[model samples]
Target: MRIELVKGVNLNIIPSKQFKTTRIFISFIKSIESKKELAERALLANYLEMCSQNYPTQIDIARKLSQMYGASFGSSVDRRGNYQLINFSIDYIESKYLVGNEDLLSGVIEFLKEIIFNPLKVGENKNFDEETFTRQKNNTIT
Candidate 1:
């Protein structure tokens, strides 16, 4: 998928016409929030990148991917101009690569759903995960 910057908005999707690939995609997002807000969001983002019920530990999750050959998955937090974008996405390699005969698309969807719906929350505030929040705050101070 080709990634091109846009003028405004939160998200965008682009497809590859030059490459004859099916069942594949790449996504882009642009976010605008105060650094303070992003700092808060970052912590929650960090914790959610951990163990979930379907896969209890980081190693467990990695093993699942190994079983599936290789499923590209992860999240990234960064700044783009005045925007701080946190893009969570997956790119399916159609029916040609190192994946199950029918598991690629489903796996991508499930991965996204996990992050979107189950991100760790701050104990009392509508902010970030506590451990990440505290750690980030401490790091910033130093």
Candidate 2:
């Protein structure tokens, strides 16, 4: 079932007894202003998907997800006509499939919130982690 939570936001619920995993996707859509903006937005998406204020490194984020039964986290940028979409997604095994009952949904939601709202930053400049930003930028350019 899919419901419109707001004017532009939606909630989708898919209950399946056949599958052992759950998946969540949160996406942002906007018009592309320029080539530079597109590149920057792509880099930003990569940086946020990889690290957050709580999980400041790739290893930290990976370990945290591993603790949650190997949940997968990622982001991607896509072009739809003249618009650009940035999507952040997570897929994880349900608690029913794990050894113990765990609230993986709550943890995943909290981590996603942190990634979207509290990205890893560097000093008072309010910029992303320098090395990460540079690396993502280079990756985007290539």
C-alpha lDDT score of every prediction, in listed order? 0.53, 0.83
**TM-scores for every candidate against the unseen true structure:** 0.56, 0.87
Winning candidate number (lDDT): 2
Clashes of each: 0, 0
Tell me the tens digit of each residue's lDDT in model 1 across 1-142: 3322233422344545555233333234446567677775555454555545466456866776565446655656777787766656554455554435454555555655555555545455655555555665575456
How much is the lDDT of residue 35 in candidate 2?
89
The candidate 1 region of ten consecutive residues with least summed lDDT is: 2-11
Model 2 residue 73 lDDT score: 89
Q: Model 1: how large is the Cα RMSD against the reference? A: 6.3
